[model samples]
Every structure is written in structure tokens, then in C-alpha cells.
Target: MVAKSVTIDFEFDWGSRIKSDYAITHVTEKLLQVFKKYNSKGTFFISTETLPNSEKYIKMIKNAGHEIASHGHNHTLDYDVKSKMDLYNQIEKSKKLLEDIMGEKVIGFRTPAFKRSRYTDEVLEELGFIYDSSTTKSKMRNRYKPMQYANSKKLIYVSISTIRDRFPSGIKWMNLFGTKLTGKKPYIIYAHPFDFLSIKDILKLYDKNKIPIHVLLFYTARIGSMLNTLANCIENSQTIKNIILQKNEK
Candidate 1:
């Protein structure tokens, strides 16, 4: 069987980063329902800043048998990061907060937007993070094949697989258009909470007038069968942390 890892960037809604936990409060519970139906597990790279009132849900996720990883404190673009210290602050604070909530160490880290800087690897290593899933083909200029992070003794950088050998194989497109899984080798697949949000739930969060007609149509397409498709992938991929450990044991 082919090796695969399922990951979710636990964060805000569609385009805007409104200071709310609607995704966590609503979408995640729905996701958990689907995951339960499939007997699936995954790594949720949570944004610590948004995890204030959602601690119960975080604990619920942990209790439901999922790995909690760091998605940084604020879901900001790393390119705008002024210094390595800034990046370190974001990632470290996030890790600490998650560990505090779950009473477990968070060794895996994935940048909010896969926007890693030149300082990313060094900062992650310094922070003692073992598994880094922030590396994608376009962002890190890495290969589009199954491989490991080279040279690093402690940090294992598992680059996320992409579609068309370019686009990151994430939720939106995968739901609308399926991924062409070719090889029997292991690969990484990622998702976000918004991808599983229903149109009614989305309208509850966003003003219906502001959301375009086409967007609403795509939202419909994104749900239903495609949403179930995501659950199917989750069942197939299992927990990403397990795959990483299995890789290291080899």
C-alpha cells in the first residue's frame, strides 16, 4: 500500500482572517463527525492565537485521537516577517500554547500559508521541532517526489506533494478536482477547515450580499460529494505523525 499523511491547517474562514473562532466552533465539529464516520485521524496544525475560547474543542480533538501540531501564533505571511526572531516568536509561542492546552509536546510545525523564509529551517531546528511540513514544492523549491529532508539530523522536513507538479495538493482543488495519486511511495496531503464548511454555515459567517454568486455556486460544488471525498482521503492517509515515525524507524 502507498504511504500517505493527512494534515489540516486549523485556522480562520475562507479569504478573510476575521478575529473569530467560527471555523473552530462550527466547522471542526462537523469535520470531526466525518472523521469519526471514517475512523480517521490527522494532524491539526493549530494557530494558537485563535485558540482562546476553543480550548474545549482542542481538548476534544485531542481526546478524539488526533495529533496537535503548530501552525504558528498568527496566521500571517512569512514573507512579511522582518526577522528570524519574529518568526521564532510566532512559532515558539504557538507551540507552547498548544502544549499547554493538550499537555503534550508539539514537534510538528507547518507555516500558515506554506510561506517559509530562509530562516525557517534554522528557527525550527532551534525550537527542537522534529517534523516540519511547511515545505511545499513552489515555496521551498524542493522536488515534487517522495523524499526526506536532507542533512538535518533532528528536523525531518517532509515536503507536501503537489498537483500538476506545481500546485500544492490541498483541500479546495482536491475536492473540486481529484488528485492523481500515481506512485506507491509515501506522500503528504493537506487541508483547511474552510474546505469543509457548508454554504449555510459560510453565509452565517459572511454577509450573503458580499459573497458573489459564482462563489456561492463553487461553495455548493465544494461540499456534498467532494466533502465526503475528503473524508475518504482521511481514512486512507491516517495520522501524519504515525507516518513520520514509521519513516524514521526504517
Candidate 2:
């Protein structure tokens, strides 16, 4: 049987503000424990702003045998306002920062909120990035226009799958049908650290005002089950970088 290829990705978007109310470290640690239980490897897309406070966690992720990728220098969506140089620096600096910390090449990037401007691809290519997982095929939000940038084939555009209203619909589908539905195509599962957090603790901190009601509800109700289903579905899992490498070889 041919080996299955799946990309299990996590985005660390918790900054200082969310940290005030929730234990970001505890949340990530719990999720990591889940991943470890299944002997699964995942790619952690981290924002540069969170690096200062999350250095230890970042190191933990790396030491645990996972890939570390850039989630941009900051979590802000000002890619359009900045000059070309600024955009280049934002991506390059983040890549360099992660590489310096991990002592390995940081080759993948996913823009903040899956939002990117016209210059985004050019910047990524110039920065020598191997692949970008920033595009979304969802019709709901004003996400990166994947069609317009198809001409730039040098930089692989890894689209996030079946995202709806900030929830991973692809995960839901796989959980329902199992790998019989996930053919040769790579199923990129994206999630945030907060998704694994406790609902009651979140409510206690901000009276249901901190996180969006829908997100809080969805995660609170389904996170545990989702994690279990996801772990089961992940067969012969590889990082985004490794998958791209295998593709290039073929």
C-alpha cells in the first residue's frame, strides 16, 4: 500500500492580550500531549510577536521533532499598506528569526488570517520560501485570491482545505468518512491553540466576550472528539515541507 500524506498544522496566534486571560502555555502543552500520544508530527506556524513570550514552547515543539514555520513577523494584516521593502523584511525577518532559533531552514509560510496582497507571492519568492499555505478556497471571507496568483508556479500555493466561518470543514468531513474520502491529495488540517482550551475557563476570564461566540461554542463542544478523530485519520503524516520535497522529487 502507498503511504498516506497529510499535513497537520497549528497556528499559534495567542499574543499578550489573550495571555492575560488564558494560560497559553497550558493550552499548547495539552495539545502537544495529544499529538505526542499518537506519535504524530505537525508544523507549527508561529507569529514573530509571540516568539518573545513563547520561546520555551517553540523550542519544545522543535525538540519534539516537528517543523517550525513562519506565521509572519506580526499578527497584523497590513501587508498592503507597507512598501515592497517592508513586506520583504516582514517575511524574511521572521524566517531568519525562526531559523536562528531552530538552527534549520524555515521554508514555509502562512500569512496572518490567510489574507495576502498582490505583492505577497513576489515577496515570498524573493525570500526563498519553499511553499505558502496561506490561500483558502472558502467563499465566506475576503481571503487571498488563489486564482489570480496561479501564474506564479515557482512558489507552491498550499491552500487550506474546506475552511468555513473559521472552522476546518475538511476535518469534519474526514472525521465523518475516514481516509476513504482523503485520496492522494494532501489534506491540510489547520487549527489554533485556543481551539483546545476549556470553554468554562474562557467564560470565567471574559464573560464570553474575549472569543467569538461561534468559535467558542464550536471548539467547546467538539474539540476533544475532533482531536481524537484527527489523530486517527493522520496516517503516515508528514510536514508540509517534506510533502513538497517528495512532490518535487517525483
Candidate 3:
């Protein structure tokens, strides 16, 4: 049978440069819709620090048929936590907060900023996390690179790459790439609603009068194109076809 997997993690933090906004909210809801339309399931790892104290949004996510997991409480990078004790506190506390809100066992942990330290593994283990999706497989590191782990068990590392790696075009290059090329497993793709929107997503809302028209249009078109590509991948493929057929047989 074809295995399908999709995972999403939010890295919201207090000192992050971007501020949450309506555009971001809209993008997130739309993301849910797109997945639902295709009858796909995904795990969403959220930062307890950014979660609204109220349970309204959490309920909405559950009602929408998505799995909720914990990112962290303070969204502190594992390497920046200073000591093993601090790291343990951060992870354990975040898991407790998320579990209380979701009323379900949160068995996953993703490191903030994808920053790794020896403490990262220790903390995840202490918290009893069954999976970790915080490592980038690519040699190149940028703002948000995709990471993939060969093993798909407790602590599965998904590609965090934002965009496709740029390789010089070559003669033997007639191929469609991205997650499909990677494998049939539902790809773990993470992005703030802002990333899908644009670099100036928050800036435009804060100061609409000063924003340039061309820049806004560029981001809009980029997101539209990206969504289209994702839709195509979700709808068409032998792997997806197999998955659907297997479900029907069962």
C-alpha cells in the first residue's frame, strides 16, 4: 500500500520579527481547507507559547480533523536553553500545556528554529515524544530549509526547506521535483502563514499606505502559484491513487 504522510509545525515566538495578522490567519484556514478537500490527514505542531489561552482555536482544529502536537512553550531554540535542566523544563512544560488544551496525549516534539544540541534529544526523550521533526537534511542552511529523515518512526525529521534547491540546469533534467521526488510519504512541510503570503505580509497590514504595489503583487502571485503546485501534487499521482484504492478495498 502507498503510505501517505503530511506534517505541519508552527514556530511562533515572542521575539520573532513577524507579527501575527489576518492574512496569516486566512492562509492557515485555507491550508486546512485544501487538505480537507483532498481527503488527506496531517499533523500540526503548534507552539504553546503562541496558542491563544482560550480553547476556541484548538477546538476548531480538532473539529477540522487534524492532529495537534506541541512545538514548545517559549519557542526557545534547544541550543539557546543554556543548560540541560532548562531544556527539560521548556519541553516538559510545553507538552503539559498542549496536552491540557487538546485533552489528548501529545507525542511529538519539534525543536525551535530547528536548532540542535545534545539537550534536544534528551529533552524529547524525557518528555516522551514519539517523534521529532526538526532536522534539515540538506547540506545548505538558510532561513528555512527542508529536512528529511530516512527513518519514519519516533523522532521523524522532515525537510524544512522553504524553496527547491537551486541546481544549475543540466541536460538530464526533465523531471518534476519537490516532495514527490523525495518520496510517497506525506511530506512534512512547515511555514508560517507569512511565508506563504510574502515577506511584507505583516508590514503591509501595519503600513498599507507605504507599501509598493509591485512587491505586493509579486508575493500574491507567488503564493497562488505555490498553492496550485501543491494542489496538483495532492490530486494526481500513482502513489495517491494507490492509497485511495487501498482504502476502498478495505
Candidate 4:
């Protein structure tokens, strides 16, 4: 059977530069609550370099029965990256950090900014990763071409695929409208705490008349739009329920 899963790749680019325990702690709890509410099991793509400061949160994730995976050491974007060696270094560093935190061998990885390059395939293979969810096929020239590297082993990229792949819409459109364009496939969604935390501030910028317009129309559509895709996934995906029940049991 085709396994259906919801992988939650969590982390903020801002965290690597400035260690904010408060932000980390709050987001961690919020995630735990989300898990409990949905009774969902997710794979957290984490940065090992910052794991030391996130011990409490890491344990919360694990204890709550979630799978911990690698995001990378520095949240570095592979496409923007300078060299293959740099990619390898980040993967290796991230693996070590995750293993140390979970006290278990790590197997999965997601790119820092959903970014990828030729180096992405080589490094994930070298690092012995079982699966990767980094490819977005967005408008980002460096990232938009998944078919270019489709033959790479166990590299699972996400995009919206339907309507005969006519025009990417909904979640798939977000990345397509950006730097890369991708076909929709199972919809692997990603977000940072700041994505949600910055909502109020973002809406406040608009005038009162515009606030409702943006809030009900644009803002809601832009953020958490994945929930619909996720709901579709949850309804159709059998493994997700099992994973969640199994994790919650622990």
C-alpha cells in the first residue's frame, strides 16, 4: 500500500543566529498541543546544531511520540550554498546533532529552506538518509526542476498534482509563485513558528477595512492553507492514524 504521511518540518531561520529559549519553548508546547488535538503523528525535521538549547523541547516531541529527523546544522539552503562539500558538511553535522539528541540513529532529512541542488542527492546518499522531502519545484530556478533529478533514490519531493497537472494551484502555487515550480504530489507542507506568530503583526499593518479583507481572504488563504491538504491526507491516509495512535500510546 502507498504510505500516506504528514511530515512537519519545524524550525525558524532566526533561531540559528539568535538563541531564543522562549520562542523555542512556546512553539514546542504549541506543537505538542497541535499533535494532541489532531491526534496526529508527524516527522519533525530538526537542526542538531541548536539541539543543545532545545533539549527540553526535543524531549517533549519525543515523549509525545513524534519522529525526529534532520533539517540540517545551520538551516543552510542547498541552492544558495557554494559547494557540494558544504552540503555534505551540513548533512553530517545535522545527523550527529539529531542522533545525540534522540539517542537514536537518524534516517530522514529536509533541506534548510526547502532548497536543493546536485549536491543534495550526493550528500543525502553519502549521509545514509533513507528519505528526503526537500524538493519543492517552486519558481526558484535553483529549486523548480524535480524531474531533472527524479531518478535520485528515495528522494521524495512534494507538489500539488491534479487537474492533469495543468496549472499548479493552492499549496503548490505558493512555491511556483516563488522561485521554483513543482507538480503537486501528496503535498508536503512546511512552516516555522514565526509564520504563525507574525500573523497578528502582519494583519495590523493593513487599515481596519483592509484588515478583514486580508484576514478573511488573503491571510487565511496564505497561512495554514495546508490544513485542507492535511485534512485530505488524513482522510485518505491510513498509516497516519496508526502512527498517531502508536505514538500516543507510548
Highest TM-score: give the candidate number. 1
lDDT of 3 by residue, 92-211 (tens): 877887788777888766667666565676667667776676765444446334442233444534333322443111101101244433432433444444444544553555374344
Query: lDDT by residue for model 2 over 116-182, one digit each (tens)?
Result: 7778889988888888887766544554443334446788877665533343335544444453432
RMSD of each: 3.6, 3.9, 6.9, 7.3
Better of 1 and 3 by TM-score: 1
| Candidate number with the higher TM-score (1 or 2) | 1
Candidate 1 clashing pairs? none
lDDT of each: 0.72, 0.65, 0.53, 0.55
As for model 3, its CA RMSD to the true structure in angstroms is: 6.9
Model 3's TM-score against the true structure:
0.68
Per residue, candidate 1 scores C-alpha lDDT tens digits across 85-113 of 89888888998999888778888988766
Which portions of model 4 miss their true places by more than 4 Å?
1-4, 13-22, 78-80, 138-143, 147-150, 154-185, 198-250
Model 4 TM-score, 2 decimals: 0.66
Q: List TM-scores for all candidates, in order.
A: 0.85, 0.79, 0.68, 0.66
* Best model per lDDT: 1
Ordering by TM-score: 1, 2, 3, 4
Model 4 lDDT-worst window of ten: 160-169
The lowest-lDDT stretch of 10 consecutive residues in candidate 2 is 8-17
Off by over 4 Å in 2: 1-23, 80-82, 141-145, 148-150, 163-184, 212-215, 221-224
